[model samples]
Target: MIEFEFVKPSTVADAVKALAADGAQALSGGQTLTPTMKQRLATPSVLVSLNGIAEMKGVTVGGGVVTIGGATTHATVAKEASAYPALARLAGGIGDPAVRNRGTIGGSIANNDPAACYPAGALASGAVIVTNKRSITADDFFKGMFATVLDEGEIITSVSFPVPLKAAYVKFDQPASRFALTGVFVAQYAGGVRVAVTGASNNGVFRWKEAEAALSANFSASAIAGLKVSPKDMISDLHGTAEYRAHLVKVLTGRAVSAA
Candidate 1:
């Protein structure tokens, strides 16, 4: 590991200020960040620890919407299942207990790992990412693999998800690590339907407009039958072939809709 200075900022303003310093990186749960540091893949000159900031650490539900602090852990979300069962399920499905206890929502989204489950939830639920600066829509937040619209020194404060009428997440794990080889999130709201897929695409997360259209017409498992996803766009690796993942996308979408 590279030698670096660590700064634990007690407030959001301080954290942001620290992050503004040259070659600075934000640390939340450190589930992904620390490992990268140890591997020498990431070597920030300064580490701005957000753990000291009390403002970024809770879950709130009001006016039919759910607001989650960026630093909120997956374990907390899972333990508070009664608040949003589907979201809790999504949280519980990430990594293992130790990881869930340490991995955070902001960390997950900020990293934007292709196989991470939270991005699917955010995209499907039309969640808003609230940062120290401006709010970004889920669609506009994710750029690509391990990338987001977050600028230098920007710190995500919280995420706000509008409560849906019904929602569910289904995923096929990669076995050893339990990372999603292919995952799907389906949400049915009064306005319409939203379907988001993760783990299969190189682009990280993407919407299934065809499936969404079909579900909006008739919110049923059979509704997704006519939707076809091209294998050409999916990622092919040791877990499964691109063709196989394409098939899983359709299969998982069916299962998610049926369960919903």
Candidate 2:
């Protein structure tokens, strides 16, 4: 790894200030970024660690919502987020034990890896992405694969998820990486049902509106039996074809709804 100055800020304000410097990069959990740095794909002059910020490292549930600190790890969520069982289940299944213990939710959301589980959970749960500057709805926060509206030096403070009446997430793993080849998260709330698909779309995690509309009318697997997901916008790669992923979108949606 390239030599770089490292700073561990105890507060978000200090972290933001440190990140404002040119060539500074935020380091959370070090699950993804560290590997990139070692590979010379990322060579920031300064590395600002978010792990020391106490405010960004816990879980709280109240008033029909679950709030997770930005720096909270997948293991933390899996252990402490009992109120949102589906979300906790999703967290528990993210990866092997080592990854679950080290990967932060904020980093996952910020990276917005198309095959990552958190984006699907956030988008389907109608969660709010809280930042140092302003709060953004999950719908507006994600821009595309490995992209978000977070500006330079901006930090995600926490994420607030409005607990749904019923929800479930199901994914077909990509084996070696355990990343999703195609994943679906289904949430049913009083307002309506929301279905978000990840690991399948070329544009990143996205809502399946047609399935949502059908499931909203009837919260059951059969509700979306006749519906189909177009392969045109799906990702085609060595693990799976666009057509195969698109098919999984529908199949997994059914499994999720049934599981929910």
Candidate 3:
């Protein structure tokens, strides 16, 4: 790991200020950040640890919504989000015990890993990303693989996800890293149904509009019959081919809807 200064701030304001300094980067659970740093892929001059800020960790629910602190660990979400069993399941299955204990929801989404589970749940559940500057809708927050709309030095304070009538997340894990090769999250809300596909797309996590429309009309696994995901926009690698991922998307979507 590259030599770097570490700063632990007691408040969000202090952390934000520290991050504004030259070559500064934010650190939550250090799951992704730590590994990248050790690989010398990320070498910030200073590391601002958000774990010292008590305000950035916890979970709360109100008005049919689940509000989670940005620094809240995956284990916390798995234990707290009992109201949304599927979400809790997703959190519980993120990584092994170590990764789940250290990885934060903010860290996962902010890093915007294409195979991450939180983004699927956040997007499918119609969550809002609360930042120091402003609230960004899930649709606008995730830009692409390992990317987001977060501005320089901006701190994500929390995320608020609306309670869905029914929801389920299904993932095809790659075994080693346990990252999804292709995953699907299905949700039914008062407004309509939502289908968010992750891990398969080359661009990033995205809504399956065709499946959404079909499922919204008939809320069931069989409703997505004949619906197909194009392989042209999917990722092709050793773990899985574009055609394989596309097939998994449809299969996972059906399973998720059935489970939901």
Misplaced by over 4 Å in model 2 are none
Give me the runs in candidate 1 sitting further than 4 Å from their true place: none
Cα misplacement distance, residue 234 of candidate 1 (Å): 0.7
Question: What would the TM-scores of all predictions be?
Answer: 0.98, 0.99, 0.99
Q: Where's the lowest-lDDT run of ten residues in candidate 2?
A: 225-234
For residue 95, model 3's alpha carbon misses the true position, in angstroms, by: 0.6
Best by lDDT: 2
Candidate lDDT (C-alpha), each:
0.91, 0.95, 0.92
Give candidates' CA RMSD values in order: 0.9, 0.6, 0.7
Rate residue 239 of model 1 by lDDT.
79
> Scored by Cα lDDT, where does model 2 land?
0.95
Candidate 3 regions with alpha-carbon error over 4 angstroms: none
lDDT string for model 3 (1-260, tens) is 98999999999999989999999999989999999999999999999998988898998989988899999999999999887788889999998988999999998889889999999999898899999889999999999888899998888889999989999999999999899999999999988999999999988899999999998899988988888788998999999999999999999999999888
Comparing 1 with 2 on TM-score, the higher-scoring candidate is: 2
Report model 1's TM-score to 2 decimal places. Answer: 0.98
